[model samples]
Target: MFRFFLLSIVCLITIPGFAQFPESKPEDEPFLDIGVALRFNYNLSTWKEDQLERGGDFGFDIFRINVLAAYKGIKLNAEYRHYAEGFGGGMLKQGWFQYDFSEASQIQVGLNQVPFGIQQYNSNNWFFNMTYYVGFEDDHDMGIKYIRDTGRWKWQAAYYKSAEDLVFSAAEGSPDRYSYDILGRNKENNQLDFKVVRRLGDSLAHELGISTQGGLLYNLDTEENGTRYAGAIHYEYKTGHSLWNIKLQAMFYRINPEYAPGNNLNFVEMGAYGANYNVANKGEIYTAGIAYHIPLETRLLQGITLYNNYGYYNKRVSGFENSHMNVLGALWTAGPMYIYTDAAFGYNQPWLGPEWENAFTAGTPGDTDWHMRFNINLGYYF
Candidate 1:
């Protein structure tokens, strides 16, 4: 099955006229383009009583299909994702339309990916892999957003519905009602982001960004009727052949007493797969990282690049320990394809660990541990 899909993808790229859209010869005519990517991975560790579990493998980890059409002042865009799991497992990730009001402003409406950060929209950008806060989740709720870009300033605001029911309260022995007050409201949650970039010289530039989200409601096994708020700042600078970026974010939340009384346990489960304990309280996290890139000038790999990054996160409320991550990688562009590889190391202090022994230990679930992953991908743009 994997081989057949792989061959089909290769043929689509090699076969001319596969992109059946008409060419855009006139400025007023609508235009269309397509993009595809194929990825694979092999695990090095196996699950066992004394070793980490392995045996997870995938081919064409992601198959993306994009369509863009524009005519007059209206624009339409759609994207689909097909995983190796099969056709039924595929999903319509993004479909949206936008109307241009002027050179500096536009309004977009549809079921589209929210634009909360640069990482949220462009995870495939070469620089994204080098950062710890890449916002890898592409979750999109039905919504609309407005964006304004003028000179050095840019901003965007969006409102979306919660993807699931809002739980008001819960505990190991008790249950509560699921709130549906905002079920039909388009603005169940709101997000705002802004940034300003300035050029200091021919070889130097800088940018600052602010992002915030609120009005999120969630009901869990321990907490009921919870609310979440977050704020983040990002800074970047570029000089010569090197670039640098840093990000800091913090969050506060409220939950029913059945969980805890403060903000510590909100959104800290590592993408939705962590154990739930009703220790309600407030929590704050501070994270920062830096990345450097070097471009090779050789004729065979002129676009080759190297990157490295390290990030640290601290939580103040949930008994959760502080964690850190380090990553290094490289990319080489070969004609219409690019080759890339990355390795990451992470460590954390468990609540029971000594001050100097916070680094994660092997052979324990939810314990501090380290892992390394590598990937080789082929991507094309039209």
Candidate 2:
């Protein structure tokens, strides 16, 4: 049987996909498939500031457990992951129950992906674009989502009660997660999202979409609610003959938060990957990326993709230094085995910069410098 997201790079910003990968649909009888994946990586990071560590290079990254079940029009999907110490021990990436309205429409209820920025992902590299850090790209929450796909257009609408509740709390969500979310002294609630994309062409497809999202940030300290909103315009060009994909996106976001006395409104705490850090209250992001899929069919090598993603964050805060990131990488797929090789460069990015506490919050603006990391990750699935 063909796997839904098995080893697919499009699952990077993984969701219990919405009947998008391949032409998958619920079969006549009850069916279940369970798979496990092991991943390891080698990295030479500048931020480590250690020659020996950089030279050592090789380490275990993470492992994943995934499940898919379907009966008639009802479907189920879930994935859990375990990472090395200090990053996040283990977490549920996503879990959702889906109901297909027809071949053209469906709904997902449970912990589902929030429709924003770009579909699946905006970047093809191992490390996604900078937007993933600030809870814009590939984010998930506790919600219900409706999706409709026409030959030429796709529409998505969702309402999230809040971010994923790790410890069953309403106040704060743990940061040990694959996708970013709002947390800390405030909680994200009553969030709504709408997105529509238009696809033009067959062999050479031009896709454009607009997305808008808004929510209330409930402050536990003051027992009141604040507001945050974002809007984005995204475009992509894919050519079957050339096997080239081009993507571009522009976004503007602002968080009008009401905090307790003495709290700064310029930046707020956003959490992910087992940590919480300051994120700028307002910013505009511009991103571009390109990928070429090489159709080389072989026993050992099934596919190859070369890509580069670049993002620039223009902070609205005065005198705050802007952020820049570029990831150039190649992906190789062979059956259930996949590999990625990347060289990532950044300035003021938490994952790439020296200071991690306030990189996105722009709290420590001038203290950051250029950093780079060379990484190779390999994954095998059963």
Best by TM-score: 2
Error of 2 at 362 (Å): 2.9
lDDT (CA) for every model shown?
0.42, 0.82
Over 1-382, each residue of candidate 2 has an lDDT whose tens digit, in order, gives 5433333323321122122223564466565666778889988887786844548478889888877777656788888889986787898889999988888999999988899978778888889998998899889899999999987889999999988877765447778888887778888889999999998776428889999999999887888999999999999886546678888999999998789899887888888778888888899999999998876779899778899999999999876678899998888877767788899999988888677887776535556777898889888866
lDDT of 1: 0.42
Q: Tell me the tens digit of each residue's lDDT in model 1 across 1-382.
A: 1111111222121111123323233436555555565444432222121323444443555556766666666777676756555322465656778877877788878775554433342222222321223122244545787888774666778776533222332312111111112221111333333333333445545555666655554334333444554555555553444544443333333322223446333333211111111211233334343444444566666455555555544434444455555556665555545655555454542221222222321213365455444434445433
**Candidate 1 global TM-score:** 0.63
Instruction: Score residue 8 of candidate 1 by CA lDDT.
Output: 22
Worst 10 residues of 1 by lDDT: 171-180
